[model samples]
Target: MILKTSKEILREITLCDHCLGRQFGKISISTNERRGKVIRNLLNCLNPELSTNFNKQKPCFLCDNIFERAEDIVKNISPDFEFFTFHAGTKIPEEIMKKEEMLKEKYGLQYQESIKQELNRELGKDIGAIIGKEFKREKEDVTILLHPYDSKVEYVINPLFIYGRYNKLVRGIPQTKWFCTRCKGRGCAKCGNTGKMYDVSVEELISELFLKETKGADSSFHGAGREDIDVLMLGNGRPFVLEIKSPKIRDIDLQKLELEVNQINEGKVRISGLCFVEKEIVEKIKNTHMRKTYLAEIDVCLTEEEKRKIEEFFLDRDIYQETPNRVVHRRADKTRIRKVYKVLTSKENCSSLEIYCDGGLYIKELISGDEGRTNPSIAELLGKNIKCVLLNVISIEEKV
Candidate 1:
């Protein structure tokens, strides 16, 4: 059956050793090139009528003899970036793929391997050996795409993710870059030709130094949660991930960079516990809702009886909040149920209170009630008109 099939396939079309062996790939543990050679030798001995066809020196009808120049194709590729692991892919010509498919369908070849799979494996091996890098299927630092027909090579450099905690010591800056609403990032008089609403953000203050060191194309800032412009992030700080895209250098000293960033930003913004992380950490940081501790200074002075009532009333209580009037225009007008873990009164200041609650609860609305938008608020409980003069995030509990 094998000899009969080979005789018929060879008579119809010319296939190189690699292409011929790939058709019966599942039948043996050996390579397709070796299998092709063995089958051809057997046919030459058993059938002399097809012997002249073997020495015709014709290009493969399937691959056009691209496999013969595998070494030359991979040797020409030189990646300038630093990477430890790489993955390879090929963009085979559509005409070649169609021809191979037609042959498989006509012969009813069930044990065939795709041209793409063989090219990826064979080219990946040669690329790894030539460049002195390991070939990886998952989490590769870089990807090399080989265009066999065009003799062109393309490289995709994966983004580098860095995890750390940041303290926004000073207020009046957004967590991320806010483009000018009128111009939308294009320079105009509205943004003083800077194309931004604010002069600097927590993202710019931190990511600028990283982009400079790594020589990355661009960056993205992913914080656990963002604080308002006026609110200060104190104590242990907030967790964030900085994604640097197409980085030319990855082996950066995080400890050294952290120190330099803190010194440059000074009292305005500071980062700590800087370390390298995978891309998965970004999603984890964004998805996990953490409990936060806050210190809010209110306008109304709380009496002794009122202070005691406020603390007891908020313990383990659920607060229903619609999107506050201030942010309803930008955010969806939906109600969110959040839990208040604990509430405490300040020892020296009668107008100050410390609130411990879930991450997304609006502390300002909790104090003022946002004109009845938030239920069971401090103002509603005390039956007075209260306003939060200032708010500060003291700490955030890390996820277990």
Candidate 2:
């Protein structure tokens, strides 16, 4: 005889349980695993867990008998992934779930279990019990995406990024990624078919070693402003953050990592403050170039008589500057009035004077006077044609 409606039986059974007792939830099977068999044998067993112990019932139409294999699913999915926490995901067959829903609408499955709720409870407990990892209802490191069709599981892995500052003692490297002017990273005769304009850069030199060590797929370099290839990065070296993608190894020794990166450059580029920073650090590093301190090694064609006067004038003052023609091609041509908050002048000799000023002051144009484009330039102030012999970034400061 066809069993009573699922609604009627489920109301009597309460919720699903172990054994053949609850196969009434699954229409595909005619009997519960053990409950049906034992209840059939007893013919008198009555448990509140179920309305009345049944000798026979239907199988789970939604989950097949796999609900019986919840233990197996947990065991197989647990491995090295065990130590880390995880969240359970149910991959119930759409067709199966729909069939149950249809039967419920037509016949009304009042107390019948839902495939989702059943899977969540049964699998969550079993998986958590096996690996000592809990099925977190909140944040989860591991998400077990289940596929019912192929019985496949996909685990999503998170990425880790490390940040640091590196000083390129070498003068030939660009600060960030530079594509081949000839072929743009694509092989071509103009670029010797290598597609790279430069053989290497500060980013590559630093990240290459890290990529190799961590076995990550790729790396990205972020910095505030870049100096010309010919200029030297002195003082503390330009601040930078190197982001490593998909790194399998996260527990790296910062001090040793710093040593490793420095060793690769062989003193040409030295990296320090090797610490783990988040993606937000990259944005901060670029936007926080508000104040840059520079030391200008100026070469002067001044007589000994005029040197002291130049020193005194530079000792304290608010110098105004505008965009220099040299950088007009790359930077926007706009007049910016940056304050010379502090100035420390050193008389290298009668021929040259070293000037140190607060950050954001363009020292190069301050020397040449930007063709009289800058006011109160050292050249304009001294009323003599003077030039900066060399320029160096002495230090950079920001509240970390």
Candidate 3:
């Protein structure tokens, strides 16, 4: 059957050893080129009259003898960036693919492999050996794509993700860069030519250092949840992931970088528990909801009885809140239901209270009532005007 198939195929169109063997790639463990050579020799011996057609004097109809120039194709790839693992891909011309498909259909070849697949494997093996990098199919640090016919090569460098917790020690700074509403990040007189609403942010403080250390092109910050500009993230801090794009260096010492960042940002922002993480952790950090404890200092002083009543009122209580007026312009004006688990009064200050609540509860609105947007608030319950003068997130429960 093999000799008969080879005789008919060679009579129809010329093929190189590599292309000929790929038609029956799944048949044996030998390389396709070797298989093609053996099949051609056997066919020539059996039928001496067809030996002239089996000559390799012409380009292959399927691949145009691409396998013959595999070494030259790999020579065009020279990656400047560092990568430990990589995968190879090829962009074959449409005509070549169609021709290969037509031959497979005409012969009913079930064990055939596509030209792209064979090219990718051959190129990957050669490139990996030449560069001293492992060839990986899944989660490779980089991918090399070759447009073999066009003589073009492209590189895709995957982003690196780092997970850690951060503390916003000082207030009056946004979690991320806040662009000027008037100029929309373009420099203008209203923004004093800075193009931003604030001079610095937690994201800039943390990401700038990592980008410099890794020699990355750009970066993005993903926090589990953010706090208001006037609020401080104290205690253990909040969970976050920093994604660095096109990092030339991946084997970074997280401990050394963490120490450097904390020292530079000192009183402004600090990060801890810095470690390498996969990209999937960013989604989990954003989606998972954990309980948070906040300490709020109110403007009005409350008596012992008033404090006791306030604590008793908020125990496992569900509070309905419309988006606060301050942030309604940027956010959707929708109502959210959150639960307050417990409330405790501070011994040092009669006006201060510590509230333990769900992740999304609006603490400031819960205190001031947001002009009836938040139901059963401290201001409404006590029949007195109240305002949260100072707020601090004391703790955030870690993901289980």
lDDT of 3 by residue, 305-344 (tens): 8998998999999999999999999899999999999999
lDDT of all the models against the reference?
0.91, 0.63, 0.91
Q: Which has the better TM-score: candidate 1, or candidate 3?
A: 1
RMSD of each: 1.3, 7.5, 2.1
Local error of candidate 2 at residue 221 (angstroms): 1.8
Between prediction 1 and prediction 2, the one with superior TM-score is 1
Regions of model 3 farther than 4 Å from truth: 1-5, 26-30
Best by TM-score: 1
- The local lDDT score (0 to 100) that residue 78 gets in candidate 2 is 36
Of 2 and 3, which scores higher on TM-score? 3
Instruction: Say which prediction, candidate 2 or candidate 3, comes out ahead on lDDT.
Output: 3
Q: Which sections of candidate 2 miss by over 4 Å?
A: 1-69, 75-144, 302-337, 350-389
Clashes of each: 0, 18, 0
| Ranking, lDDT, top scorer first | 1, 3, 2
